[model samples]
Target: MNLSNSLDKIKTFKKVGQVADNLGMETYVVGGFVRDILLKRPCKDLDFVCIGDGIKLAKAVADALEGKPQISIFKNFGTAMIKMDEWELEFVGARKESYQNHSRKPKVEAGTLAEDQERRDFTINALGIGLNANNFGELLDPYDGVKDLKRKIIRTPTDPDITFSDDPLRMMRAIRFAAQLKFDIEANTFDGIINNAHRMSIISGERTIVELNKIIMTDKPSYGFKLLFVSGLLKEFFPEMVALQGVDSVGDKSHKDNFYHTLQVLDNVASRSDSLWLRWAAIMHDIAKPPTKRFNQKVGWTFHGHEDKGARMVPGIFRRLKLPMDERMKYVQKLVKLHLRPIALVNDKVTDAAVRRLLFEAGDDVDDLMQLCRADVTSKNNNKVKRFLANFDKVELKLQEVEEKDQVRNFQPPVTGDEIMAIFGLKPSRVVGDLKEEIKEAILEGHIQNNKNEALELMYKLAAKKGIVNNPDK
Candidate 1:
């Protein structure tokens, strides 16, 4: 395979090639850039590998670019980075690696291009496009990477066991690539992953989560998750999700497998939105069903309060997974807590009051919540699915009408603490809080209109009932 086309895209790359030739070093554009170029995929970030000093080549390339780009050198790793134009270009010296029994970090030594290919995690990533003048445009594919790329397969450049055992993070990367590219993992490589899944224990939660987030961000994220569950990778990182898998039966009746159901929901949400955490909320929406599962002779099986329980589990799950424990964590928690609200509207009468409360609680996320609820309806029966969908349409329309009329989303009570305090001439106390709650509930429940005057009047009545005198100034 020749890669003159890949080199042709970047004019500055030619200068580096000339500089490398002058310096007596063999340098090639290697790894993902080469793979993506042959696959006709768009990639801006480029990785270059050289047989000699990478820092020298990186400095040369930067210098060739009129010397303005910032070149960061890492002497310990024989690598350098430059943020040129729109992409990050990293240069590294070709090296061999030998890992320890207890750690993924390897003992590195200067080596040839073959050594670099051998160290690559996947065959597709081992392909390199030579930039040296003599072999310019020639693509080195010692591992048949182009063939594997053509077949849309995921296989390591070296033996799967050696690749994964050297760095267990490669296992996660393999699954992430397979999911993102919609490719099949080679049988031997997948088996090696399963065999070495336990080795992931040596990896840190932070490092593991980086690949986990990539898997979640894919178009069909559930595929990667299912692979993780089946191969026991998820159990090591997220036991809570794996716990949602099995079905519990009693007296000839069983509940839907919440684990697979969660995956279906995750896929459904992914089909509509690209938000990673919202998709996470879909995956964890029923995580507590197993603990809350119940069986009765009449109903067969039920998961009561699973939503509330799952919401409670969200903080713990985020903490364990190394996910953000701030607003993002709260966003997911909010979605999990309210996942069932819209669905509960489907089977029963879709009411304006119910929709208003949902809009009020969900606020700007009302649409995402509705999407999650609709995706939550994963019934196999055609009629049930159709019925739920039709009912959801009605619920959505009602929500729009209610939101437009009441403006209750992210609603602040028309009556403020100052107003309540002024009206009742009372200091900060339970009475003020009680009055605010009363005013907000009145607006939400439609007992009184969502207006300042109406709220003030309602506040007065409550204060009168509570035996508080009105402020003479008002």
Candidate 2:
């Protein structure tokens, strides 16, 4: 089918095609740009493959454009890129590839357009639209990519085994695309992923986590996690998450499967917010249950201290996965540790002191923590879920009330340690720290207002009880 009308809208396509025509090089807009056009997805990047020197064609096209935008050339890979007005255009020469058993990196050489299309990871991605003078906007679908796109299926252009084994990263890509597009992996393509799951060892943690994060960021990430679990790919990289898959029973009592529960919680959080780190907090909130799980005749099952344990586990997991060891990791860690706090308030009396402590600890993250806690309600009973959610609402209102009254979220002591030392004529010691702690606690407990006057009064009384008289004149 001719897509000339669509091509007409993108003026750069005509410029590139004219440049390639002048240079006598066959060129087509290929890969995701073409695929997204058919799918009607908003895309800003274009990938063009030419039968001749892509770099030369890139320079010619750059000069042909109105401003002669600067082009970046990768001579080693025979690829070039230029950015023009919210559009990134990439040019590459068509090439064939051969891979060794131990590496995913392919030995590349110049080849025909058909060879290049054959090497594509997925059928849909292999679809190309002509940009040459003669075949402008002509659809090229030698692998029936348009058909697979219509069916909403993920399939390889060639043998699945060859596709996956050559680059195991494609296995993750297959799953990511399926999750992102809400498409099903064709039977044979899925089986290929399961069969070559072991080959993931060759993939770097950085590369693997990129795909994993994309999957996690999807609308309903649980679907992707389930696919990863069933395909055995998750076990290859993240065994800790896989360990949460089963239920243990004692006589007639059994705990719900923590793995599926975590997924449900993830979906719940996803529905409420689009923050990736908050979603990550949901994934890790119960990650320690497998190790901390215990059977009790009275309670049936308990994952006591799982929150604290899971918080401790976050650093090591982040280190291994090559995730940033910055505030983002600490944010996830803090959320994991405090995930049970708001729930405890919902179960208990929702005291001002409890709310103060939670607000102080969670700081600016208090709202996100509440969101995670709300998502953690995964009971099957509708009444229980509704009751818990209603109680959470009450706890949230109390939090807001207390925060407005006390201003304890990320609160600092009204009296500094230096002020205490100077007021009491004492050197820096444990006594100064103890005095600061007392003031902070008294403010949080509502025993004293969080102000210099009330804090100083409490400090003087505590010091007098300790037989230390205030000597501000000293």
Candidate 3:
């Protein structure tokens, strides 16, 4: 098949072909760019594989361009890169790879394009389009990749076992592609993943997380996660999530399977927001239920303090999964901690103090926290779900009223520790901290407005009780 007409969209392909012809090198646009072109997906990056001297071909392509795009050469990997207009173009010599039993890194040697195609993780990715003069735009499919693409199937070019055993990260990629493309993983290929699940230990956490994050960012993240769980690959690194599986019962009183519940929450969050971290919070919201579970004759099953325990587990999980340990991790932790707060306020006499405290604690992330909580309402009874949603709406209305009246979202105290120290002629001490805490508590409890004058007056009353004289100038 010819892609000559399709190549007109980006004339760079013709230029690349001309340059390859001048340099007498066999070149083809290979891998993801070619696959996306065939699939009609929007792609800005292109990968080119040449029979010989990829760096030289890259430099030539750069020269052929208008402004002479700067070429970056990686001599070790026999690859080069160029930024051409809005496109990122890469060049690599066709090579075969041999992996050791202990490592995913492969020993590379120059090989034919056929050999290179054989090394691709998935058959659909192995499709290539010629960029040489004689066979420009010709489709090269050694493993019938185009047929697999048409069938909407993910299959390895080689033996699935050998393919996964060679680079176990491909197992994650198969599921990620299945989710992103809305395709099915071939049964044999999927079974290979389940069979070689333990080989994932050879892959690094950082690499695994990149694929996992991609899966989470897809339209329905739960789809990929289900595949991960079924394949047994999830247990290799994330046993905490695996621990959430199974139903416990004592004389016909069984708790809901938290593993499936978390997936429902993840899908709910994904439908509402594209934030990967928020979706992560949904995944972790009930992670500690297994540990904190208790059965009572009076209450059936209770997962008391699971939110707090789940929040505490976030840091260690992030550390283990090689996820960012910065404020992003903290955001997920905070959401996990505050997930049940709004639900707690659904009682008959929900107070403004509760809403104010939630505003102060959640600040700007209150909306995301509410989103997660609403998604957490996966009860089988429609009436129960409706009631929870209605209460949530009431809580939201009250929060708005309280916030408009008392302005406490991300609230910094009008009274500071330094101000307390200055007012009482004291250095930083327990008295300053105590006064500050009292002022904040008073404002949150609606006893006093969140203003400096009111806080100042309260400070004087508290300071007098402590036998400290008010010395404003000090």
lDDT of 1 by residue, 49-99 (tens): 999899998988887776569999998888899997888889999999899
**After aligning candidate 2 to the native by TM-score, how far in Å is the CA of 61 from where it should be?**
1.2
What stretches of model 3 exceed 4 Å from their correct place? none
Name the lDDT value of residue 393 in candidate 1.
94
TM-score versus the correct structure, for each prediction: 0.95, 0.96, 0.98
- In candidate 1, which residue ranges exceed 4 Å CA deviation? 346-351, 422-425, 470-474
Worst 10 residues of 3 by lDDT: 415-424
The list of candidate 2 runs beyond 4 A from truth reads 347-350, 421-429, 463-474
lDDT of 2 by residue, 1-474 (tens): 999899999888898899999999999999998889999998999999999888988989999999889899999888999999899999999999999999999999999999999999999999899998899999999999999999999999889999999999999999999999999999999999999999999999999999999999999999999999999999999999999999888899999999999999999999999998899999999999999998989889999999999999999999988888999999999999999888677655557888898899999999999999999999989999999999889889888989999999999999999888888899999988998898899988889987889988899899988888778597
TM-score of 1: 0.95
Q: What RMSD does each model have against the real structure?
A: 1.9, 1.7, 1.2
For candidate 2, the 10 contiguous residues with the lowest summed lDDT are 342-351
**Best TM-score goes to which candidate?**
3
Error of 1 at 21 (Å): 1.5
- For each candidate, how many residue pairs have backbone atoms clashing (under 3 Å)? 1, 0, 0
